[model samples]
Target: MDWMPAEKAIEDVRVIAAPEPRASADLEAQLARALSLRWEEVVLSIGRTQMLSTSRTGLSLAQRDRLVRDVSVAILTQIDIFLERKSDRFTFQTLLEELADEERTSVASKVGAAIADVEMEKSGFRFRANARELTFEQFEATQSKNIPDFVYDSGRGDETTPSDVVAVEAKGSLSRLRATKSRLKNLAKKAYEAQVQAFVGSTANDSIAVTGGCAIAFGATPGNGDCTLRLYVSAPAGGTDSGGAGAAVRGPGLGGARIPRSLSSAANAMQQLDKKHEIERESATLDPQANGNGPGHHRPGRKRRRGPNAHGRIAFANYETVFRLCGAANAALMLRQCLDGAVEREDNPVMQAFYQSSSDDRFLFGGTPFAKCWSPSGYFAIYKPAAEAILEALAANRSTPPDSVTLPELPKDLSWEHGAFAAQADGLTWMSMVRGDFTTKIWNLSSGKW
Candidate 1:
């Protein structure tokens, strides 16, 4: 595909920061339009050339899916960059400053840094601050107590009691800007609860006081896209269990309360294109001629028996398809490890028996390192040995040998390039052993059994 054109389109779309007294509505509009147009072009190209038509580029179905995923990631990365611009009020730093200014509190400056420290430590579940870890018990105790917007030690050796603790609550949205208000409310409740717990654990003096507030950053705008910073002096009394009963505090300046029309429109347009592509794929799958299914001519009662050869072909085809998509180096390494683990494990009687009986080192690998056996042709060679091992084990103890092991049915149109059999990848490592819902035949030897 002509990827350079699309890349250029994305590069050309620039969002200039809005000056004071102006909103970013125009910039958002331009970005939304440019991105949406490029997205439509790319999606339409994939749908028409790859999904709807037969593959002429020699790329497998799995490779096509990976390509689509890569394109989607690129689009999302651009959106992330746009939202992360320094001048945007939706940026994390901007929101913190707005919250501090609204509360007219000196402690707000430290709230952002404290939150950063807690996050970096991965202690959100049990936050560590002030050189100590606060448990859920402490958090619950101060649920009803008033907390400050920012709190810290005075560093004066004379006074040791914890006083005027600041609690900060902040939330931001990139995709779900519309949910900013509700998310902020939820964060506010959580912040209050945490602050209250800290205060209760720190001092017996209830008069020491706690102050705090909530800041919501959202949308592609200067003043955080309709979201405002709010501050609270004390925890609300007898509130709706959420500690939100305090008087509503509003910050200075107008906040963007709604997502810009252009942005939402662009998002909706891309979604529609994706939905359209899905419908087309479904339609193609259902068409018998397109999927390689011949006219029905089978006797109704006759049971079709699939032998080890069929099973092997299906496994080989599915694995090879995925291996090509994931790249030869990574796929070869992972597949070998999966097969090796299955063979070594004592829990899986089928794999254990197969490995013991089979002398073919080409497919079974035996004790040989995968790096030595790695080849484009070697990938195709391993399927039969893997399939035979499982089939042989299934037939060993059963009175009536499983006449045919069911495997995952591939799409009707998919050609095997060899003997006919259907299969799907069960994981990155193994393919389905049989078609149909019979759980016993499925081989996940890497995990020991089906």
Candidate 2:
């Protein structure tokens, strides 16, 4: 190992981030239909990316089907909320404060992500690639424990060079008002994770040499039982947190791809996490006692099978895992059922073609056996390549590439302006028409090889 001078042991990564995007005011039916289609498109695309005929990609056909079912249902549930409540975001935000820890974390995740995209664009950055898909070796350099949610280029450069870029992460909480403000203060620590990702991306792109900034947005309470959102950009260079003067974070620290970061940066980040955890525990409901139970503690029903997580390393269910547990026939049937449940018309060719994909589960799913684990390799395959591929295909068909068209790309995509698919009962309304549906029939994956 090469020795580094003592004075320069730590590398510092920092960024400027902020934003808020307004939700679109589309009618309930239009929103339901758009979100439903998006939910389907995203799920199918992810499964396709994860497997794509395993002989070609080597993923379990059954696992792909299972993932499509599990992940699609989870995404649909969130989209359904908008349909039922219309645009009353506050209702959802306050109710969020009352959810169980698992559910709250889930909701906060989606909300934080939406906020991060807006914050980055509002500060002038165009989407590049998702940092979550980058390998951990990249993150190791920054010495951060978390991953940045997304990466973006400023798009201000000429054809000869790429724009300045930044890694951005979203931090959020729906805890009670007091806790919300406290949580936001410490959210700064999470930004360095983004900085690390941006740093790595820059290394891959030949050190185009652009500055980076962190984006943090969290629920804030200025009134009783009321929740307003906020975005924060850390005070420049002086990363002097409330209690510590770890070091002054400055400059891009460009061209030092091999440099080691100071231990203080990692320490401060963890310290901030511990402090935030303590704040969340301010109420009795947040954490029950017993540190003595220790790190590997397990409580009854404590572990949950969250469908898929970008950060998960623990092996959960993947398509191949599910296919092996449930024989090909049953697995295929499960896929058929879920796909049928989501169908609105008998003539919707795209929906029809997916379920009628293939007879052989190996071929039916896709063949990337090694990539079948529901980890960063498969579950996390949801972003980057798949979205880019679809958008690229879409761009080729249109005169103006989507990357150039500056509209509210998000909720707008889920609105009437985006057009709709024909269905007797639009969206999940059709999903409900079939009572005792196949979606509720959980194919237990626990009875198989772990």
The candidate that achieves the highest lDDT relative to the unseen native structure: 2
Cα lDDT tens digits for candidate 1, 104-196: 122222222222222211211111112111123334444323432222211111112321222333232322332254554454445444543
lDDT of 2 by residue, 302-343 (tens): 331111111110001122222322233433333222222332
Residue 177, candidate 1: how far off, in angstroms?
Answer: 4.3
- lDDT for each candidate structure: 0.26, 0.30
TM-score of model 2 vs. true structure:
0.38
Alpha-carbon RMSD of each model: 26.1, 22.3
Which stretches in model 2 have alpha-carbon errors above 4 Å?
1-69, 72-98, 121-124, 132-144, 177-179, 193-202, 205-210, 220-227, 232-450
Best by TM-score: 2
> Candidate 1 — what's its lDDT?
0.26
